[model samples]
Target: MTTESGAGARVNCVVDAEGRVALELPAPVAATRPHLLLRLRPKKGEPVTVSRTVPLEAVADGPARAVLEPLPALEEGRWDAFLLNGPDDTAPERLRPGLRDLRALVDGHLRDRPSPVAVRIPYVTKEGYLAVRAWLRTAHAEAGRIDVGDRSTTVTARLHGATFEDGAVVRLRMRGSDAPERDVRPVTDGDHLGFRFTVDHEDLAAGTAAEGGIWDVFVHPAAGAPPIRVARLLDDVADRKASFVHPAARAAGAVLRPYYTLDNDLSIRVATG
Candidate 1:
């Protein structure tokens, strides 16, 4: 979970290791006996709200603080948290650190009831999107190193937290306008796994009118577990010192580069002459 606080007021919060939320606020705020409100709304569906007016003794030191534990644990989804002055208070002034850039409903009469006050703040999780995640008991696939060549591509990887037989079927999942999917049998060397894929330079070019030149690498473990993304786990390479540079691409008047996106999803950039 990500930690956020009120922008105008002195407040800080973090989700602890045990999944409990710890909030710290100014001593003055606690003296006033103002209520602490927590509102979580998923991107879709109904919202969850909780509130309390903690005592000053709850303050660890000079600053006042409190901890909130979800009764049954937060639901699985992208959740937005709001630390407000009152329980479900719609007053603009009562708004604290929350989502900003939300346009005020210009036509309030268009709704069944009054619209809630707008908060002009932006708060996000550590990954920039607050989400309740669920992890599987099975192992996860990790991408190791990629070997990019003029005619083919090779991927080195490992399965963390679980092991499988030598013949576990691995595949490369690609998503784009065309949405092409390919299968490859990875050769296992002890704990390390290796896969090779053929590439067509002309078909990967810009003039080919081929769908978006992007592929999302994915792997399916043999134990019938869900597929996982093949991402860049190795150290990022500098542009000038990329390990998989292809001189043939330059001679062919084309560019083929593989990299990880901002979200750490592995992708390849193929541009034709």
Candidate 2:
């Protein structure tokens, strides 16, 4: 079940070795034991599917609990972590290491080595409006939530329970990796979230392809609520179409780039939360 604490998110995950694990994220989540699953990049033309349930027994105990990869020992006592950048009464390392590790991993997974899918950057931010959520910046964590750890720390997400009306203009900047173009996707629904906004081809400059590039989008949250992963926008090069295949963007060809290029309607649509 998907639950929310402030902005802390509870979702489900399954890896090869582990069966299925329920995770409360925006917080640092590691295994209670060892032996876990690390998300793998699907081979050429292979679908990026993760339907396996990780066995708890495999990770019942050990020096390192795991995910898509084995994590280095965290001296603070944590084995793994995740974050959207929030502050904690605990040490800094406990709250935001996920962002640091993510940067390194994203760099390694550039266009040349990018997965067939795309993933939206977690732990979002706004420049000036209000500090809604944070990972490592303590000054900013006040408005959000936090989860501290011994070997590691877990922070909670700041849930605004915010909303936007239909036809609200929005913008999405890619957080990591590159694409031919950056496209902002705003999907509307009546579910807890109205629509989604994240990047794809339309968000980047023209003629750029999604092989090995990194991109970030800036939006004014006033445009709408934060976006969650839906489907990644696709790519069309030389009149041939191929989809962005990151596991996060497993579904093919629903929304492609340019909600409207050069329109400047969104004001980059990001607010400083």
Q: What's the CA error at residue 204 for candidate 2, in Å?
A: 3.3
TM-score of each: 0.50, 0.22
Model 1 earns a TM-score of 0.50
Global Cα RMSD, each model: 13.1, 20.4
Give the Å shift of residue 203 in candidate 1: 8.7
lDDT score at residue 138, model 1, on the 0-100 scale: 32
Report the lDDT tens digits of candidate 2 across residue range 7-63: 332222322211112222233334333222222224569763532223333222322
* Model 1 residue 174 lDDT score: 51
Which predicted model would earn the best lDDT? 1
Clash numbers, per candidate: 2, 80
lDDT of each: 0.43, 0.24
Estimate, for each residue in 16-44, the C-alpha lDDT of model 1 and write its tens digit: 33334555554445234444443444345
Candidate 1 — what's its lDDT?
0.43
